[model samples]
Target: LLLFVYESDASPIDTFDLGPPNTDVTVHSAISTAELPNTTNTDLAHVMKLEQQPLTTCWPGRVLYLMASNFSDKQKWVACLEAAVKSIQRKDTIVRTGMFSKTLLELEGSRRLELNCSFALCKELVLLGADEGLFCVNLYHGTHAIITQLTGFKCVHQIVYISSLNLIILITGRERSVVTIDKRMIHSRIDQANSAAKEETNPIPHTVIEGIVGCTVMDASKCHGGSYMVVGMADRVLLMKYNSEMKSFCLRKILLTRGITL
Candidate 1:
């Protein structure tokens, strides 16, 4: 099994290949756009473009998935994928240099961009306080844009994956309680904002995780099973699980360790 990860400016996408080793898995290869029309291999894969800009604070980008194309004629498609790669690389270079002056307010002001946030999944950017928030410029439209904001006025720490339910787990603090929101809600907010500019409304939907097990400024949260979320504090990690059988989150386990400290 081989896993390929791709990182844009913000989040990462990961994909895996499960096949016999060295058995000609060349169908999935990451190639640049300039390498098109030339044949070095037969198998062709999907092409992906970095959707977000790179962070300036030195945080490395997340690795996404392996290339997989839906087009016919894998070899020819590979050529197209190469072309996309070159285009993305060129665009990324320009975006990185341009992001310095493009703050969220400036982008929103000139473009009428709406902003929202959530914790359930990893966002391309987080909009902080009044001055510091995420901002993105429309290369295609030449407009400045800011994505949605999280429900609870807090900063997102880490996002965890729940394989059993196929849901993203979020960890946020500096505010009371943890919250989870569905990805669909984000789309709805964006659509609503676009349709109704004069309507004074709350854009993002929020579900708060109540009943504090413990508190810490810097901590990591993990989902175990059911509705339970385990939080790692200074000296211990508390497991908070939802007993669907009971319809409420409950503390299930507590592990103490020096290294496990969040």
Candidate 2:
């Protein structure tokens, strides 16, 4: 694919050739580096705080997702990575470039962000897991703003949206708990935060998995469109199944690696 990094759509800065597609399909499936298994391992302390800046968005700016309107489009998540890199690179250099934005959203103190996941149930909102807690950034009114900040979670590592179940899964860095939140509740909270009579609401509806003070959750994700969920921890990889009868997540099994010391 040809990637064009331009000041504006009318003016082009540079073009990058991404070479020939590996297959005729154009886009390839990939996995994140963190998901790969390795012998080496280290664990974080039980008590550690993270620092971060406010949430930000670059939807149509430097970072853009060229998604086909059709839901079945195979290139739904395939985007222009090289073009975005060049645009941001120019801005970081001596060149006074305005290819993108600095911060679409801002807040007090450093909002050290750990992980972020997007929610499309209602409006376009980004759920940011940070040192302070869980923060939601809304993309409406032509502004990216921190709508609400949910406390209690000292360090949140991952947040995943389960569309089929209409659930939001939160993984803590130290607690090793998977908290479940209803999508409707989040929508209500964000809506209330934007209204005249603002009130704080509990975003998490129930504790799917709890009281595991042993291991820390490293990462988590949903599969089969929320039918199943998986979490990686310091000690083991947990495979959780969604119990439709109970309407909660239940630990199906734990896969642990044995460490060999010579």
Candidate 3:
């Protein structure tokens, strides 16, 4: 390892090679060096008396004595070096513990191959949307089932689930329109798929929320006695309200944004 010191502006001033011939032992406090009978470094002893603890990189072949400007600085250096050493000692264990992966499914051989998919999660249920359709996977029981096949969608770009209203909104990339589905429909399909113990199935019904087209991004929230949706378009933003009686979102207000949004 190479340790470097930098100026306040981050310009490298000095570097020490703490590898190979210079690094095989533990670092020790400067006060421990004062107790050594053969200690000849009066500077280190003096620094210890001034409340600045020093450290020695006591390499097997050579020793590099280092001192900090203050007690806090010394503690920081000691803590960092000790942490680095601990990290090196558990390098393999750390790699093994930190890395993980799981294969969900193979789509290459299936005709229902998803293209440009979007994903959303609600508790143990995972929602996946593609050009072909929307799918729900129950992680608890390993049930993968289709919620609905979105009609005329070239690709599903974004999927948002509003738990407050138990509704899901999907944005189509090519059509530039919004599709809404009930969360109850997803759960019902998962239940049916789990009982049948199958992978593929017919889709549930869905409603395409019309009028609002050229949608860039959309989000919904329920607050202050009502549920609202904020939909972004090429030149404007639509603030729509959810009408529970109609089971659809209705346009409420519009705000013009001359430029595109994030």
Candidate 4:
């Protein structure tokens, strides 16, 4: 496993381990180097050329976020957030068009076919709009829906996972606050509005937390079948506990000092 250590004024430091649990951590400095070439690129290029294709392709919009979901078999699927409408194109056809074909054609005929294929958007989405409000996308049964808007927050820092309750907790750096959204509620709303129109609606959030002040770095990890979260603020770290009844997290302990500032 890899461990990342971040300092307030310095670049992030990383350490890697390849041994058992008793192994001591071996720290390594970050390497600033060019990307290594993929071993399969040569084979891919040959196949593309044989199929009369182009070597490069581009997506339609600016990508805002990307995430991966792992399966039990260790396979992973990627989810992307783009500024505009998202679509998937066939790689074979994309190469044949030299990376610029908006439409495809049959080799033996004059018929034209569009290469745009619409897909369902990802479920656990957090879109930070220009207004600094978070717009969440909830997907269920192959349908996409929007949940509640998280306003009065700026610069969403990170999302922590709560595996026991299957919840996603969002932390904000601007407000030094945290909020939790009910995953089940989002799924239920999508099911209830399955056949309805695709208009946006505002639903109440599970919980909203505030009153904390400063820039904060939040981190979470699962251990011993439970989740523990740590929030590093100006001078100290705050420990929090996930409360299933409240559907939000509560601060359990606060380590305070007077020497920390943003």
The full ranking of all candidates by TM-score, starting with the best, is 3, 2, 4, 1
Cα-lDDT of candidate 4 = 0.42
TM-score to true structure, per model = 0.39, 0.51, 0.58, 0.40
RMSD per model, one decimal: 16.4, 17.3, 13.6, 21.1
Candidate 3 lDDT over residue span 71-161, tens digit each: 6777777777667655654654543344333555434445355655555465666666776655555555532433333233347778888
Pick by lDDT: which candidate is best? Answer: 3
Model 3: residues with Cα > 4 Å off, grouped in runs:
1-92, 95-124, 140-154, 194-199
The number of residue pairs in model 4 that clash at the backbone is 2
Winner on TM-score between 3 and 4 is: 3
Q: How many steric clashes between backbone atoms does each model show? A: 28, 5, 0, 2
lDDT on C-alpha atoms for all candidate structures: 0.43, 0.51, 0.63, 0.42
Q: What's the lDDT of the predicted structure labeled candidate 3?
A: 0.63
Residue 148 of model 3: what lDDT? 35
lDDT of 1 by residue, 168-213 (tens): 4444554424555554554455456546642222546555666552
